[model samples]
Target: MNVEKFKKDHNEILALVAELRTITQAGIAKNADAIAQQIRTMSSVIKLHLAAEDRVLYPALAKSQNPAVAKVGERFQQEMGGIAAAYMEFAGKWTIGSKVSSNPEGFKEEANNLFKALHERIQKENQELYPLADQI
Candidate 1:
């Protein structure tokens, strides 16, 4: 397996998160089309990434007997579900365009929480779980 590919994906996700922060901040300042585009791009990227992990990575990791590995896989699945739901909610609000930007504070808050949780989970998987899986 190409661990570098996983690392690259991780970096891409971080970059997207950074873009999201900027977009949300801009939205809070005023209604910005760029924010809407960023949200759309983020939604697409996140869904693709999660699908790839679910199809290619998680199943492999779940095959392991190690309790730590199994636990990580379970946690990842749970987090992915939460992320998917949050993405849907964000998309719905964002589709409302100006209305979403008008009250960007709440949207930004939720986005921040989701981003932080995802970051932590990704970091744990990359630093700990992935390495162990590679050994298998």
Candidate 2:
């Protein structure tokens, strides 16, 4: 019923993605510190956002008498595991700016792919999940 926090988190994520894209494009070697900081910030935000969904959003949807709603929630929750795992691996691999700096192009490629996936997920939630939450 209350999706304000989730919307806010989505906005923050998009903002962070934009910032990362800009800084990474400018040059990872020169902007490693900034890039690393952004990565850390995004990681923190995403972790919290996912936890909130697990504790609140998913449960609410699961309670819905509508079978479609319950299935949607289950699908979203299950799909999240892969994304979370990929994110953890990405974050761990590039914990240090030096690691990112060591392979600027690789980092950029990986970051772009990962961010795209995350962006798509957020869009789906905003368009589909949140609306369902409101209806229920």
Candidate 3:
């Protein structure tokens, strides 16, 4: 069974999120070495995804010349700032081992919160942004 590339990529990204959540929940002493590395890798993948979405979709939608679409595009950009800030905070903090590994439970809670926010952002992009892009 050959999965579509985007679908495969999306699934892998979600899986990585879950894996990080699991690792953090397992206690950092046992997984300390791996946590930062995994988060770094995930951050890179996420940036790529976001950049691609920005390149192909956001600009396209914004420049659509349709009043409704342009409005949506503007709102989308504004809304994304919150999501982006949250992600950046998570990514930057987790890159420092001491911050993430210092208190495993605390780290897990923060990670889960960020992951939940990311999941909602992705769902919004897929549901509203992607379709808006397609509409144009």
Candidate 4:
């Protein structure tokens, strides 16, 4: 199952999430450039990570004997698509050098929603899905 690789990826994502949370909070408090850079970095890392999973882990999990686990993996993939769309939408809205202060509340709301969902997904993967994958 390569639990070490999964753990490493999980930790990296967690660190990125922390950075993202700081950047978004700073943006809400009037620092747009930092937020923009963080968003760009996060977007790249996330896309790459998802691509790796879709290319490797998902196919392996789907072919496993456990129907319940495979179904969960499929559902996770769908949820990941939704998260990716949300990230892209937020990235589009908050371009570099844009005036975040002009619409701080809206930006903050979107960032919060995105982070909350991401955090929940990460928790689930770390606590439930990854271990299950290891067992399988």
Leading candidate by TM-score: 2
Q: Quote model 4's TM-score.
A: 0.85
What pairs collide in candidate 1? Answer: none
Model 4 misplaced stretches (Cα beyond 4 Å): 24-29
Candidate 4 yields a Cα-based lDDT of: 0.76
* Model 3 lDDT tens row, 48-128: 766765676567777886889878878988887788788888888878677666776777778878888878876776676
- Per-residue lDDT over 1-136 for candidate 2, one digit per residue giving the tens place of the 0 to 100 score: 8898999999998998898889888989999888988899889998999999999999999999999999999999999899989998898787688888899888888988898899999999999989988888
Candidate 4 residue lDDT tens string, 1-136: 7656766776787798798677665545467777777777777777777787788777877987999989988887788888878878877777663656677787778877877887888888888778777866
Task: Candidate 2: count the clashes.
Answer: 0
Lowest lDDT block of 10, candidate 3: 1-10
TM-scores, one per candidate: 0.81, 0.96, 0.83, 0.85
Per-model CA lDDT versus the true structure = 0.74, 0.90, 0.74, 0.76
TM-score of 2: 0.96
Candidate 2, residue 71: Cα displacement in angstroms equals 0.8
Give the winner by lDDT: 1 or 3: 3
Residue 116 Cα positional deviation in candidate 1, in Å, after optimal superposition:
1.7
Off by over 4 Å in 3: 1-9
Please give the lDDT score for candidate 1: 0.74
RMSD per model, one decimal? 2.3, 0.9, 3.6, 2.1
Model 3: pairs clashing at backbone N, Cα or C within 3 Å? none
lDDT of 3: 0.74
Error of 2 at 109 (Å): 1.1
